[model samples]
Target: MRLDLPCLGVFFLSVIPVNASIRERLSYQGLFGCVHSGLLDHTGCHHFLRTDSGMEKTKSLIARIQFGKFFAILQSYANKDHFNYVQFSNQAVKMNQDFLEIKRLVESIPEHDDLASELSFPSHMFQLMAHSATFLKDTSNDKSRGHLSVYHLIDLSVRILALHNVRGVLDSTNSISEEKIISLHRELRELVSTFVHDGDSESIMNWMFQDLAIQAEQDLQKLWQQVSVHGIACLSKTDQQKCIQLP
Candidate 1:
C-alpha cells in the first residue's frame, strides 16, 4: 500500500492487490507503540487497532480487541452500567460446573483440595453466566445446563479468568468507585462477594459487599418482580434444591 504516513486517513490504497490481507503491512508493534495513546480521548486504544485487515482477519482482530478492551475496562474501572444480570448469573453457574471438572481432573494431587477450594467461586460463575444468556434459555441447545458442551466449558474458563483479572483490580486500588464496585458484584448476583469474606477483610471488598441488597434490587429492577425468573436465583439453587444438577 502506497500512502501518506503523516496524514493517515481512512482512505484505501489502490496499489495493493484488493485481495491482500492488511496484516501483510500492518504491525502490532507500530500500532501499540507509535500510535498516539488514546487515554487522552475516552475512546482510548480502540481506534488504533482499527484497520483493513481483510474480512476474516478483521473479524478475528475485532473479537480479540473487544475482549481485550472489555478486560481493560473492567480492570481499570468498575462499570455497573455495562453489567447484565442474567449474563452474570449464568456465568456464576458455569463457574461452579468448571470447578467440579477441574477437581475431577486434579483429584490425585494432595494440593488439589486447596486449589479446588480456591477455584469454586470462579468455576460456578463460569457455568451459569458464561454462555450467552440470550442463547442459554433454550435448554436443548449445546450450551444449556443439560448439554454443557466441551466448547462451552473451555470458553467459560477463559472468560472467568479475564473477568478475574478485572476483579483483581479491586485488591490493588484505593480509588475504585464504591458505587461502581458494589454495582458489579450485585450485577453478578452478589455471588462473588462471598469469596471476599473468607480471609482478612479487605476494605475494598467490605465496601463492595456493603449495600449489596440495595444494589441487587436496583440492578435487577423489574426482573425481580417477574415470576418466571426462577431457575437461577440465589446461587446454587440447582445444587441445593436437588433439581437438574450438573455433575
Candidate 2:
C-alpha cells in the first residue's frame, strides 16, 4: 500500500501527456452525463463549470499566493528562525484555498481546449500544505524537529511556486520554445541549489531534495527530447551534462 516517492515521481512524469489528453476530452455534456447517471446533478454540473469567473479568479488567486507575504515567512523559517505557527497556518489555509480554486477552474473549462494545459493539479502544493498542517499539530511539543519540518515545507512551497509560474507562462503562449525550456531548466537548477546543502546528508530532507532534483533533471531531459530541434542541440555540452546531473 505504501508507494515509494521516487517511483511515484516517475509515475507522475510519465502520466503528464496522458493526463493532458484526458483533460482535453472533458466537456460540459460529458460532465452532465456523469450527473444524469446519478453521479452528479444539474447544480453540481453548474458548480463544476463555473468557467466564466473561475478561470480569472484562479489566476488572480495563484498570483497572490505565489507573490504574497507567505513566502517571506517561509524564507524566515528556512533561515533557521523560530517557526511562526500563526503565519505558517495562515499561509497553509491560503494554499488550500488556492488549490480548491484551481480545481474548480480546471473543471470549468471545456474539453479539448489548449487552456487545459495551463492548469496542473497542484498535487505537490496540496501535499505540502497537508503535511505542514499535520506536522504543526503533531509537533506542538517538539520544537526542535519542527524546524526541520518547516524547512521541508518551505522548500516544497518554493517548488510549487516555481512550477506554477512556469506553467502560467507555457499556458499563456501555448507553445514552448527552446529558449524558454532552457530558461526553465536553469531556473529549476537555481531553485534546487538554493536550499540543498551538505549538512542535510542522511536526513529525510536530504532525500526529498535529491528526489526532487533527480525528477527535475529527468523531466527536463524528457522535455528536451520532445521539443529540441536536434534532440539536445539546443543545449551546450556543459548544459547537457548539467541536465543529467543528480543531486
Candidate 3:
C-alpha cells in the first residue's frame, strides 16, 4: 500500500498506518533514519526526536536542498567561463563547516530551547544564502532568456537571507530596539527595490554590483547610526568583512 506522509508532505510506499509508533513506523516502512543510523552522529548526539509538526521542517529542508541545487547550476555557469572551481568550492566548504558547527551546537542544546535553535539555524540558512549569492557574483557572463544569472540568484538569496535574518533578530533574547528593526527593514527594502528594478539576468548582474552600491553604502551609514544607538554587540561581528562587500 502506498502512503503519504502528511507532516513531511512526501509520498512513500508503506503498508502501515501513518499514526503508528515511531519505531514501528520505521520498521513497517522498511526505512532507516539517517539521523538515527549514525550518519550525522560524528558531530555528537545520537537521537533526534521528529518534530510533532514536520510540514514546516520539510519545507525548510526542501528549501535548503533547492539552494544546493541552485549552487550546482551556478557551478555549471562558472565552468563555462573558465572560472576556477576552487574558488566556489572554497566558499561552499566554509559554509559546510559552519553548518556542521551549528548542527553540533543544536545537538548539545535541547530541542525545546527555541532560542538557541533559532539563533543557530538562521546562521546555517545565511550560509546557504551567501553561497548562492557568491555563485551569482562569480559566474555571471553575458546571458539572457530568463536564465539564472548572478544577480537573479543574488536577489533570490537576499530574499531568503532577509527572511531568515529577520527571524533571527526577532528571536534574540534582547528586545529588538526600534532603530535596529528599522535598519533591518530598510536593508530588506533596498534588496527588494533592486529586484524590482532589474528582473533580467544582464541588468540584475550589472545593477547588483553597480546601482546597488549607492544603496548599500547608505545602508552602512544607517547601520552606523543604529550602532550609535544600540552599540556594536547587537551585531554579529565577523573578521571576514569580504562577504559583506559586494562585487
Q: Candidate 1: misplaced stretches above 4 Å?
A: 1-100, 105-107, 122-170, 177-180, 186-247
lDDT by residue (1-247, candidate 1, tens digit) is: 2333222221122112245444644543233232223223323333343332332222222222223433332332233423343554454454344345434433434432333333334333333334434233443343333233222322333443443333322222233322333333343443433323436464322332334323333433333222113222323432322222112
The residue-by-residue lDDT of candidate 3 on 89-169, one tens digit each, is 465555556455545544554543443443343344445445545655455443442245443444544444334333323
> If both were scored by TM-score, which would come out higher, candidate 2 or candidate 3?
2
Cα deviation of 233, candidate 3, in Å: 25
Query: The CA-based lDDT of model 2 is what?
Result: 0.47
Model 3, C-alpha of 52: deviation from truth (Å):
27
Superposition error at 50 for model 2 (Å): 9.0
Q: Residue 36 of model 1: what lDDT?
A: 23
Off by over 4 Å in 2: 1-80, 85-90, 111-114, 136-149, 152-156, 170-187, 190-202, 207-247
Best by TM-score: 2
Per-candidate clash tally = 20, 2, 1
- Candidate 3 displacement at residue 51 in angstroms: 24
* lDDT of the candidates, in the order given: 0.34, 0.47, 0.41
Error of 3 at 113 (Å): 4.4
Candidate RMSDs in order: 20.2, 12.4, 15.7
